[model samples]
Target: MSNQHQLRASVLASYGATALEIEELLAYNQNIFDRSFSTLPTKFPLPPEPHVAAWEEYATLAQEIGVFQALSSKLVQLQFPILEGISQTQVYRFATRKGVSADDMVEATGLILQQPEQLQLILHQSFVGVIPVLLASNREDFVSLVQALTMRNEPKPVPDSMGAYMVTGFNNWDRVRQYRQQWSAKNFGNCSESSWLEEFGRLILQKHLYQDRLIILSDGFYSNVSASDIGLSEVEWRRISLTIRLEHECTHYFTQRLFGSMRNNLLDELIADYRGIVAAIGHYRADWFLRFLGLESFPDYREGGRLQNYRGQPPLSENAFKILQALVKSAAENLERFDAQYGQELRTLNSQPIMLIALTYLTLEELACSEAHSYIQKILDQLRTSLKEAEEHLKSKP
Candidate 1:
């Protein structure tokens, strides 16, 4: 067999399955897919709407047949490659307010049980977005998007979480070692160098063992930090930022704990990214409003303005990096000028200096999606014209 096939067989071995078994699973999946797409449903039920026939049929097949199970199993296995690439010394950490231990699995499971509805909703969203790809007549583009979305940096903590995980690890070696030891003790074989979910799973196990409510305090980028309180059972999943976390701390935290059960990494990251963008924008705008009212200080301009305005919250560096990469220098320069023009207000509002820049770049990406070159050129012209107007506005300033 080729090396590639050997590798696949090796990975499958962990599940106590032979190569033939894996192939059988693959064949089964293909058959299901063939059947599923053979008769495409006319309608799909979106959220808040009653489940339509199409929705029920798809959902039933996905959940009941071994499709979801097989996909989920493979996703977990594929996570090894992705997680292995990340530095373990860089992610996850135990929360300060409440530390966890191996004995806490029972309690942690209860918290998850109590919030089963939320978890289900997360699954539904993932299914909605990904099923189209699985069901698509021409699925190459959809598959590519799914891959991109899966790899996107959608989680990570608020600034404080980062400080606790990464920065603190650098400063507090003893505690860090203890934390890692505790993680290992709790997770054992499941913990990995780059698996944030595994570390997160360990935390959950520890939290439950200790019967602590604060175990799930850190909020991922995808989570809803505000409406999180609406649940009566009193479950707290706090938002933690990546900046302050140690290299591997958060990765380990997320991998074993939360990631293990999640079948769709692509949708998971998209939901998180969407939520992160909304929160960052909201926070940026709020800071702007606050500055207009002379109520707050400006955000830090050099360090992405996160420190200056948001204080404890920062955009995921990965997303920031992508935004920076997508922009042309001229477009980026114009955004800098725009931010500076409203410096006092922008600073007051806690806006990241990069946000406006990122948004403009995103607009450029949206423009690029068109197959018509003329359409793209027109969009570029409009952007240039808008920038020129902004420049004129700036020039007229005293």
Candidate 2:
């Protein structure tokens, strides 16, 4: 075997791939023959105009909702879905008669951990730009709220493993109402909702509502792994897990706002998890990441491991699936090594933005290859130079 072949064989062996499986992977040969990595951009792209506008609008809404204030006095309440045979009004009255405050009602309905006042609207500063974040402390509440908001108040089943949800181009009904009134006056010289106006509103106005983007985050253990699993106390683990979740979702927000594409894919997950891990603990742990993806035992993937979530659109064949697992394992190990060597230098320069920008240039296949280190190092060097020059330019300004 050639040196490249020998290295490939070695990786497959380490992951406990059977000889037959190795041969099948070699035959598939997608990763083996094609090793193209994109050239890194000199600077990160600016956030798109629409994204910037959306952030501003969300900030205004947050202020209007008193998101920054303490939770004691706010009486914000969401119209939670009514249970079977019970009117929503009755539910509210029952809770009120029982002396349940609005906050307690929300909590008792499993829509949030505490009062609705505790729901914070954070304008998180990210490399792309400031993105709005709706931070929820409870996992159950996070799932339900996301379903309600994104699914038109429908009671959809949300997966327990999902800790964060991104809301993009979400219609603000308040804005929709204002737009409808204006449109009605312009078209018919009246603001009343006639039958024709209602039909038009249903078909057309709904599509044109002022759209916004935000992330709904849950403060759950990263990948639902408890503190005991990672050898940490409950409090410390919860804190770190929240940081990881926030950073992970922010990474997605970064890509969505800048690259204009976000998908349910392993490569995206890998990149997000890398940023999340580094942000939380200042280093990458391949084992922890693998565990998060249900690859801790390699050949035997855990039943509910996150890896099952991104099996591709049409899904991969069994042979292809095995090969994918091997690739992911190799890629993760390479990333961990890269972080260990360059993490301190990157952190010293506060280079997360540039780092994330550089990472977008490579693929999982390229990262899994034997030359992965060289490929990443080349991009990092270019990004570092750009970052330094930008800093120098800023310093010269004042």
Candidate 3:
């Protein structure tokens, strides 16, 4: 076995895997991919019409009432450009006017409650599926909106310098449904809430009916790194930064939707960052990814970079963390080599999804092993065969 395989086995052992069970981990991960393969959608879903309409109307109201103005004022007053400075408690107190029923303030704040848009509400068509995206041009507005939705209008510390947020299974009260309910009450005296009406309302409204998944993105340099930091012009960096950030979050959405897991783990980050870089630049650049993770100067981890975010559940020991770093560096470099060789073939095959699926089949350790390229190629080949068989079956039916 090569040194890379030795490192792989060492990392697995740290996670409580016995030396003999290394292959078991590989088999387990492969089983997950195999199970998910059959159910993966041939075509991703478009954004639901009703959901789009509801958000559009809500965004219009938020704009008309100057909610963005209030939010901007509050953010400035707090001297926090990002939402990380405020707590959810603070946001709730400010928006509710200290629990007083200031009707106008409450109404305006309520409308601004969840993901109030500063720029626009885009129905983004991602590789996995269409997801609603709340694009905020101003960083302050983005921070405030993220705080309102994720922290319940309360002030809370967001530790990392994150550029985008993905909200899943969000139980949001539908403003459109609220407006319709109010209109009905005003036109008719004391309209009783019937069971059928409740069910119908649930169907039409985003509220208790469905799991609302949205991506709240900021127009900021990725990971709060400035344009000059990477030697790119501001205009060019901003454009690429936005693409990378959106695709990064979408990659998480893809895994969560198809693989039943989205984790704050190094493996997940590596996979997402790979997809993001490819989407932005048409190929993966290992050095760019290393800089993003603060691993540009290998063996010397940057203190405040994203690598600190995935320290494991109970956290790894110091020596184990260093080993993990080595694994990440090796895996990233291996992926770059694989991409350089087979990128065009993968693209021509329209097998980006398959590529993602293949990644899920291997462990971070295996990805760092000497035969990583061959392992990925083997999985890709099998997936291609399965895909072709499915297509032929459909053609025969017609």
Candidate 4:
């Protein structure tokens, strides 16, 4: 009977994304959480002995091999992981074990005709270390360290098969429009091919490799960059950095760690994009992100994007997803309230950047888990109550 419920029903109808009933979605969330969060039923398979779990170690391997380098700009000094010789690494070994050939991977990368060694591994260090370890059956530790490394920036043209390009309507209006049209035609008419599966085939491998210490895995990263053989140019790389993307991807790092790596956790995507947009640009603008996703044209685009991301993997219950969309929509629409309460404290914290960063990730974590509508109201109420506490505390600071 509330606006939130109405929005959820409308958004679901728009996408035709199959959502379970309230009870069903609740059960699904429970089942998935237990499956993913709990200890695995079986030990992760490792490479046979004689091939020591770390038959090799590459702490300075990237530096020694010289495939990827780190780049610095005014804002962020970004580092990525790129490996030239896929045939030699555990990545290829594990892909092969999973029945995906190196050739298949190369094809997926859109770097076909290029040797596996020639294609790059564009990942973070966390992925860099554990990938090979898991391939050889060595990912086990009581404590875990997930360190992701961004690779050096290299300008290479992406393949035609990777779906849409990352260029925006703001920059190239006509082409972007055409690209969106083509996408609509495609999503409407055909089945989406798993070039993404091959393009990002490593994720299939990532799904299985979690343990206590030294557990290596990627929570999530769908960088709107080259998924194929084409490399990124300085111009494109600049777009990624200066725009909302760097924050966007960084948000994935935070949320993936918080929620575990999976796509379509709409809350994860929305919160990531929201925090990324707000933290970087200093206000919330759903239009830019919605446009980026090609969902800008949707009549209910903001709510629609949230729905689509939910459909990506459906992290919350059906009603819960709807509630989330409404909650965020209400927050954005009622910015004065948020700003007066939590926003002021956040602004004060942002004066010192590191504190702001920590709070941003933690706030997102709290918001993601507060699914009940009443719980959401309670959080907002607390934010409002914090105002009085701040005023009293400040007056008492003498």
Candidate 5:
């Protein structure tokens, strides 16, 4: 098998195998899907096939039963479904990256941890990685986010019922063409940049009516390129994911009203990153992992009011590599702590171990930023406090 195949399987295995019954059901259904999807000629313009009926059978079966529901739940955990568990008040604050104050973040944090394990069980059932598969298939979230960028935010009152229509335009080869057009002058081909840009453009263009919107989501990684090349880093990726989710829901919230879009890319990005971290910590205590990894801090405010790393290095600098290694080590140490405390409960919960997965990314990112030790600590302090409150709230409920 290819390296990519192995990696994907490794990720699945890490979450612990799905229930035997769920594996059987999905396997059979998958066979049916493969047989149906395969018979179609491997050519463009995937002809108008009436496979919706078959698809509906698969979809309905998953939803009405435990396996699919569990799979969906687990996907949210692994991907850190940035938009799923945030509170409504936080929706805008988090989206704008200012919806929640420090106090609010603290309270929200407790609630997240306190949520009943039974609820999380829904995420770890039959096909543990169901959400990722769905994300790949629908591409809806990604597509919708790109479409949101076309509109400008107006400065008028957006009615509570105003709804926007955000659609994804291209999903295949056509998508490739549009992406190439957007970054024609640059060289992005080296890092799966071509494909990523293509999909991003299609999503953005879908929102031809608007011009001041943003989207947050993760892109598939092809290589180990550092963040200096692009204007994003490992830590920034998590934040970006949160920002896109906010823009997506905001588009829907302000659907069809005369609301001008918000500008200020720097502020916009900063807010997204900050908000993403806060929300992620609440659900997964991921910020702690970032802290341990030493890759958790953003560039310090430099001369000219811009953010720059103290090291003056390019993306994924040598320091970043060292940080990553340290993070892995630290995480192993912490897992022992976790096992000592909540390990048994974890086994009984029977839910997807989202905590471990989310923590992994956080720790890795933190390690990557180890050079900025002081800055990393500050952010972690804030993140941990917020998470504690969110957890407290969750526990209080039951």
Candidate 6:
């Protein structure tokens, strides 16, 4: 069965969403869906497992249900359905990096276990990574955080409203490490030629786990990375995956907020990753960009940034490649401008939405300048001129 079909079947079977009920609910919209219900039982076999695998099915179900909820919950609030155990408040998970050292362990655990008040204070300060996702959600899942960002005083405590999951639980260090390793066994990939992602690290996505809530997932990884490259020591587990990966996902939040939603857009991916690298390390470096893209290679290292590596030619047309090259060049130059124009504005953008508006246009370049937002056209205009000049230059080549 198709993944979509399987996913539909899985969600319903697992969640007790019997086909009859769905058919009744959706009959007004379309009957085909009602008639094509899978013959699977109403309940899926097996209880949820301790591993993330247990949550996988639920994740799909939640996301799908969340989408439906987003579209119809307001109109049908009283009739809106709920997941089995997901909470109503927003949940943001923070996980240990694959290389999380004992020091980080102590810091996180100390805050959580030893100093509850301080931990609450810090989390409040950090604003948690998941908040942005809600604000940027196209599904309109979260409440406004604009007030939270603007207020300086200790904002009203979220109390038990927010939740977190440390990727590597600290209770049993060895057992946690073993479980993490086993978990990452499925998350294999390369970071250049040398860096091997043996352990998983980084926040993957901001997903819906329950009603009007979010859940962040992470894994730890062991990679042979130079401490000097990202400017860390030999044992900084945060280097392995925590800092860079989390920052990247945060960028996804940023992009989603700026543009509408993050779809299958290559420009969005590159821009997000680029901004993420900058957030983690203070400045944008081309080598870091290349390494993150798995475009660089060295024999001694294990390619670490990639989760899955594609071989052979990239799936891009020549024209598309040219456009991408121009964007990459623009991106390289903009790296220096990151701190000046883009970075600060990214955090707080009242006057200048150009940085993001420009990116939105770049992805939707198929739109005529007339059809596109003026600011987007203005952004793409410069790139178009540059690309045209390069094109003419290539044609004039001897």
Which residue runs of candidate 3 sit more than 4 Å off their true CA positions?
1-35, 44-53, 56-118, 175-191, 194-208
lDDT of 6: 0.33
lDDT of 3 by residue, 1-398 (tens): 36545666665675556544554443322223334556555543423533445555555665666545432332222122223333334543453322222244422333232434346667677776677787888776676667766665444554445778888765433433454466576757545556436644655554434346778888888877678888999999999999999988988887876776777777788888898889899999988887888888988987778888778666666666766677788889999999999898766425777788789877888887678999899988887777777777778994
Pitting candidate 1 against candidate 3, the one with the higher TM-score is 3
Lowest-lDDT window of 10 residues in candidate 1?
Answer: 161-170
Error of 6 at 246 (Å): 2.0
Q: Write the per-residue lDDT of candidate 2 for residues 280-356, one digit (tens) a residue.
A: 99999999899888888988898777888887656666866877788988899998998899888777424776676
lDDT of 5 by residue, 1-398 (tens): 25423343333333343344223222211111011111212212122222222223334456565433433322112112233323234433342232122323332322121122222111111111111112221233333222222221112232211122222221222223333455554755543756655656565565432121211232321112234533467677534443333332332212211112222122122222322333333222333333322334422211222122122222334443333234333433343344345444433222212222122122222222223243333443444455466666667996
Q: Which stretches of candidate 6 lie over 4 Å from their true place?
A: 1-231, 235-241, 297-314, 317-330, 337-354, 363-398
Residue 303 error, candidate 1, Å:
7.1
Off by over 4 Å in 2: 1-117, 176-209, 348-350, 384-398
The regions of model 4 sitting more than 4 angstroms off are 1-61, 68-243, 256-263, 292-309, 312-341, 347-398
Candidate that scores best on TM-score = 3
Residue-by-residue lDDT tens digits, candidate 6, 276-362: 555565555655654544444421223443312211133343333333333343344444444344455444422122333345433
Error of 6 at 203 (Å): 30
Q: Positional deviation of 36 in candidate 4, in angstroms?
A: 17
Q: Estimate each model's TM-score.
A: 0.20, 0.69, 0.75, 0.37, 0.21, 0.33
Error of 4 at 258 (Å): 4.1
Candidate 5: segments with Cα more than 4 A from true spot? 1-315, 348-398
How do the residues 253-343 of candidate 4 rate in per-residue lDDT, one tens digit apiece? Answer: 4333333443444444554565555655566555544443434454344432224434434356555555444444433333323333445
Clashes of 4: 28
User: What local lDDT score does residue 206 receive in model 1, on the 0 to 100 scale?
Assistant: 45
Estimate, for each residue in 335-381, the C-alpha lDDT of model 1 and write its tens digit: 33443454444332123212221232222222212222343334434
lDDT of each: 0.28, 0.67, 0.67, 0.33, 0.29, 0.33
RMSD of each: 23.7, 8.4, 6.6, 18.8, 26.4, 24.6
